[model samples]
Target: MEELTLTTPALLFSAISLIMLAYTNRFLAYAAVIRNLSEKYRERPQDSLIRQIDNLKLRLNLTRWMQIFGISSLLLCVLTMFLIYINQHVVAVWIFGTALILLILSLAFLIREIQISAQALQHHLSDMEESLKK
Candidate 1:
């Protein structure tokens, strides 16, 4: 294996930063949608609305986990750089590897969330089709 250096972990800094930004944006969008859904549910209280809210709740939890893992990865990367700075090359390599695993987990959660979102949209489209038939 190649010798681990400070610059190695530094490379992930910008990539992780951009990913965190995208996660934050996704979180904000979910919050807005939940607020709107809450108001609508309060006014009408339909079964369909309840289902949608439940789906959103699951998606929101997934989003939270995604952020947690992503942030943890970023933190680990920073720690890896610190470890290298202090001449702990072996530990730094291990930490950097763990950080990469965390990032992979975060992306996996993101894929699941996107799949759920697509399913939710499909449900809406099906409902619209049914209404049109009626």
Candidate 2:
């Protein structure tokens, strides 16, 4: 059995990066949903509006966390990679590997965000239409 010289931290970093990109896309999708929802709320600001507003807040919170995590992970990955490049040729592979993992993680988060946002949009639109018909 071969040991993973790449290190756990490195894999984590790559995963973080992928997550960040994914989250970014998600946030963008959520923004679109917000726009649509806003229009619906404007048409008739009833009690249901509060629920949608809360839902939007939840999504925004997720977006904020994603951004915070993505930025922090990205900076750390870059710094670690640079340090490895300068000081540890032997461990350079592990550092860069970690960085790669972080990048991927960042993107993964973004993807997750997008899927959730799209679903929310679809669900909300259905509800909004149903309400309008009544």
Candidate 3:
């Protein structure tokens, strides 16, 4: 492979920043939902809300890891740039490659979170359908 340059890893900075921002937003929204659900659960204690809360808990965990990997990737990208600056081209390439892999893992977790969110929405829709059927 051609020698990697500092520019190559620098390119990821904006992308990773945007991704981290998105993940943070997701975390914030989930926090709001969890609080609302917790209050509702205390009031009525419905099974569906409990299950939804459980799903949200899992999603929150996934979001946390996604943020972790994404931040790690960002840090590695910076490290790779420093390596290149120090004339360590070979090590820089390896570190950049690892950063790319970490980014992919972060995206995978994002996809999983989306799937869980979709399932939760579907559950809500099904309940609406059942109510309408009656």
RMSD of each: 0.6, 5.7, 0.7
Q: What is the lDDT of residue 13 in candidate 2?
A: 63
lDDT of 1 by residue, 33-75 (tens): 9999999989989999999999999999998999999999999
- List ranges where model 2 is wrong by over 4 Å: 1-14, 88-134
Task: Identify the superior model by lDDT, candidate 2 or candidate 3.
Answer: 3
Reference-based TM-score of each model: 0.98, 0.56, 0.98
Question: What clash pairs does model 3 have?
Answer: none
Candidate 3 lDDT, 35-123, residue by residue in tens: 99999999999889879989999999999999999999999999999999999998998999999999999999999999999999999
How much is 120 displaced in model 2, in angstroms? 7.2
What is candidate 2's lDDT per residue for 1-134, written digit by digit as tens? 34333243455666565766766776787688788878988898877667767777777776776687567666656666566647664465555556556555655655675676687679779998999999
Q: Point out where model 3 deviates above 4 Å.
A: none
How does candidate 1 fare on TM-score? 0.98
**Residue pairs that clash (backbone atoms under 3 angstroms), model 1:** none
Residue-level lDDT for 72 in candidate 1: 97
